[model samples]
Target: MPKHSRHSAKKRRDPRRKTMDQITAENDSMTLKRSLTATQLLLMGVGTTVGAGVYVMTGTAAAEYAGPAVLLSFLIAAASCLFTAFCYGELASTFPVAGSSYSYAYIAMGERTAWNISWLMLLEYGISCTAVAAGLSGYLNSLLGIFHIHLPQWLTHTSLQPVPGSEGTALTAGWRLDLIGFLSVILVTALLARGVEESARFNSLIVALKIGVLFLFLIIGVGYITPANWVPFIPPAQANFHFGVAGIFRAASIIFFAYGGFEAVSTASSEARNPTRDIPIGIIGSLLICTVIYVAVAAVLLGIVPYAKLDVADPLAVATQIMGKPWLALLVNGGATIGLASVLLGLMYGQSRILLTTGRDGLIPSVFSEIHPRYRTPARGTFIMGGIIALMTATLPIDIISDLVSLGTALAFAMVCFTVIWQRNYAPETKRPFRVPLGGIRIRGFWIGVTPLLGIIFCLVMILPLLFNMVHALLGGNPVPVLLLVGYFLIGVLTYRFYGFHNSLMAPSRPHEQGTSSHPE
Candidate 1:
């Protein structure tokens, strides 16, 4: 501990004295267990990325913008993610910590930047996890339907859709709760609370089943591909936004959320057996796996049904229905349910880790940092996150939750990648276990990291339109996301003002720092 004056002795032993150097030291005494392998980390990345977006959004994107050309949208999103992945790979390898982008920002920028990103991470992980869980509930309903089993209307669908659909599952009574979504959050929270290893094992098994189901659909659906669906692949231009070549980019931006699953994997750096090698492998490998599957699925889905017909809640299930395969459709629905559930597990786990980091850094209440003695996890914070997610699932629709996630992700990913460039200049001598390729080569009398530079550009391309649309939505009275963002921002700012600013480990006038009082009296 740093030396402190006698008058300042009442403060709890200040963590402000701890430095990045201290955390980076070998075999440090942090709470998280280091048991995750490359395979487990990779599976975690894959599990989160291949959820409802591919199962649901592919068709939506096709119906709205790209038509049969949404396959290229997946490829575009994947390329942007690859560059962002490259940035993540280098940082996670170098920092090797639990907070993911928040940790990287702290090392490269300062405390305030880390604080904002960590707060946004709540949207990326916790809120989105809830949305995905809600989606899982819908698919679970679809799966149960295969057995002629159906829940009451209010039990499954929300009242967000004013005119309820024919399934009689959607309710006209205002503000109906998604009972299954609420239940899934609690169940997944229990799994997370048990232990990370146990949760990871379940994730691995379930992810395999999900992927196998996707491949089965691909193999079977290939024969049903009508070549006529390929004509007029890029839909004609529409008035409001991008169409033609621009439509593909717009679709890429929407589906870009699918590739963000790897960010959750990066947060597990503190738990990996060998973070240097494993982090990069986990991030890149899983992205490749998901990208191929997403592209193939998009092609097959468009081939089976017209783009206009693809705009349902469960696109894959709809495609299977068109193919006259009810049983296979049920299997696809089950796969989506399992896939979305695994995503919830990973997101919840990652969110708690980020919360714990902020707590340890004195950005939030330190109690959130405490790890469970027996479970070796952030037990308190994980459960707290669960309750919040559960509330969100019951109140909000899946689409609204998804929009928040995309905005948060683009902001976080862009800043994280930008941090790589900043770090190169700010701490040139800092030991890097892994450096992003194409960055080391000097250009115009400056050492620039090319990958991160392009990453920032790519992320911004996706972020700007979303930002404009969000502002437009707020102007049009869709206030949920704006209200949520402002509410969280105010809470974070107030926390910083009242608590985190003074309590921060990096604070200049810390308990330990020796300084004469200005009054001197």
Candidate 2:
């Protein structure tokens, strides 16, 4: 070979540049049991995707942003997620692995990008799990109220509550902690540590019950439609992202949290019986099903009660109360309580798997990679993440956590879309059981497909409002969210530089350590 060609080859062989074959070898070496079927995977996606959004976020979006037009917000958010879901389907099929976007980035971009994506997954899965747990606490409290059992406010509420006249611009600490939310995480973590198959079965049952509750609401609540409440479906502009056309977009961005879990199916690829085909089915099918259910339920919810009255913790329960049906309210709250627990299960499960994959790659501590000998699950990592989530759930308010989760989720999704385009351009010969539709023109030797391009654009749409709101909040004297995000980014960078950059399994010095046992050092 020519001298220049030899130099180029040597440079391209950097450890960070993990090839598709390397990723496939890693997948082949995974020990997580392959017991989940297409049906279970679909239910997992649905179980995670359908919660908090319908049970909690819908009310906030309606009352605060788009009013009755929050249904449009659901459609808009679903549209964006649908595109990204396609990108996820393609990537998951091509590279069925545990890390989901992180593993995909490792193959398509490099280790630095994979590390960043992994950090974002922490925000997406970990914090989102916390947010869901917080929402579940509200439902549980409401359900207990139906039985005339009232928990103490300090025990049921978040420690940080928004200031009354601060319009969510300020938070004040109080002697409060969501005990139910904290305990809920612990229980689900134990369930996940038990095994994936058992968790999937539990998730399936919860998904069915929630779906039935939503259908019940639709069937009965549709009859209570007050046409006047939806008079101005698109309420006039009161402020930026407050009750106008912009509000629809803003609400879409906020409620985008609702669609956060579909990609979680991709994280289950390592444990899938037939990942190539099943992962795609799970990702896309669940999104389509949940979108229809979301739109239908939103319409019924708004018709039964004016959007103005929906800014409460338990919106469906509030709606049932307005209709003078205590029985229905009890059932709705019951469904939400059980339903959000499944979301916790799915999110925590995905978070642990991401930690396992990242740890195996040496981006984080190896303890996270430790799989239980008997259960074949990442028990150690699950317990650790669950503890963090439980603490967050006990302290932070859901509104604050949800926005950060949505921002992280949107960015991760955009990276997933870009990975598809990158892989197609660089590794055209790679076999893909599923391909994102809408073939596109090659740009300077890079295949920029239409579907992935649209996915990227929609993802931006879903996050722009969030960015704007964060900026607005900063200007209005609330720098908490922005500071939190920046702090997280800096922490990620510092950790990568100090540890991951040197210890990565792909590092030249650690080449032989790529598939070591998942026991702690």
Candidate 3:
């Protein structure tokens, strides 16, 4: 090679010039304000998990798939989430970083893996906030009608959305926009831009209100559970994806979104006042709580109404009406709004944190990592993402884009489960305040930890159908959100090429701890 070119190549390979390597132990540049208690973290988890899935998914899953056995579907989904939650508990304690799975992946996998996870996480947050906002819009409008306040149909509906069951345009006649969903994202973005502490406090209160509303549903609706509804619990499967055992698995996969909040907890590890002790508590505790709520609500919802009649957007509200209680319906609608707001808050908060971590590692622009001088949050990135999401809500009918968030999140969970076992084998000496139980029992040749392995399997099981269906849609000429996802990933690649790759702050760092005890020095 020529002398100048050789020098340039040497500079590129210089250990000191490496960016992601520097992001290993702890970050030095971007600092997030730490002010959340364990309760706040738990609240954030519960708020995120208990949102649209319970309010919207329960009816649909029960109606279309699991029948009354939707309760079993909830159990199956929650169990799958618990295994990954154990892995998250350990990583949150081990790294105590803002990036969550991306941080753990950095330690266990490599810089490139971490960057990819971070990119996917950005999608997770953006799409989650978008979908939740859209769902919340419907409930919000319903609640508004209680006070005789109703927006025009065109302002409230999306444009040219094909109706799911039959030949239709998702609504009657004229071109329209889902303005309410768009405004919902704008409102959440504004709240998150302020700071984490404020957001957590608000999330906690919302969590409490929604939990109370759920309990009220159980308290009232349980008495009216007609014995007939629970009889054919696992209704026979009529078709491939409809009611049966296959339907239960399908329901579990669909309802997996109910557990998105627990993963969101790890993103707040940096902000947790006592991360090592509290993150585990938040992750596991919230899973347990949400599971109980889902099980009870599913049973009651199916009991109050036939499983066949439970496919509406607002299941809990529908249950109340069947029981001849419009007042209860109003309260349930109120809870749904609070539930969605908290979900959006958690998703957006996690999204910005992922961006901050990515930027800090020079995997993206450092401007995203720039914390507000006064608010102590990633204000610029939060608003940018918010604007991006708000624009999508207004212009793009995101019916398909929403599941992209769920897919990305499930992929991240699987990655975290992989990280735990990898760390157990690779860095056993590393300090972990919470470790996954029944671990390190190697099976056969290539397997080690059983807990995380189950998590990985289940995660893949959940993700595969979504992948297949998406590809199926693309092949059928509906190349919508898939194309958008491709574009988004292309943008990330360009960002990496233009800025992240060469500017990375990586330095040589030990992947495994060098302990005097282990070394016997």
Top lDDT prediction, candidate number? 2
* Number of backbone-clashing residue pairs for each candidate, in the order shown: 2, 0, 7
Better of 1 and 3 by TM-score: 1
Give me the candidate number with maximum TM-score. 2
- Give lDDT tens digits, candidate 3, residues 1-521: 23464355444432322222344334534566779999888888899888988899999889888998889889888888999998888888887777888877876666667777788777777777778888888899999999999888888877646557522223333477888888888888888989889888889889999999999999999888997988798888776568878888878888987787788889887788888899889999999999998898888888889888888888888789889998898899998998888888888788888888877666677788888999988888888888888866655655556567668778878888887876665455677777788756654323377789899998887887677767767776677657766888898788766766666655224324211111110
After superposition, candidate 1 runs with Cα above 4 Å error: 1-18, 25-27, 158-175, 440-446, 474-484, 508-521
Give candidate 1's root-mean-square deviation (CA, Å): 6.5
Per-candidate Cα lDDT values, in order, are 0.79, 0.86, 0.78
Off by over 4 Å in 3: 1-29, 163-175, 443-447, 471-499, 507-521
Candidate 3 lands at a TM-score of 0.88
| Winner by lDDT between candidate 3 and candidate 2 | 2
RMSD of each: 6.5, 3.7, 6.5
Better of 1 and 3 by lDDT: 1
TM-score of each: 0.89, 0.94, 0.88
Please tell me which model should have the higher lDDT, number 1 or number 2.
Answer: 2
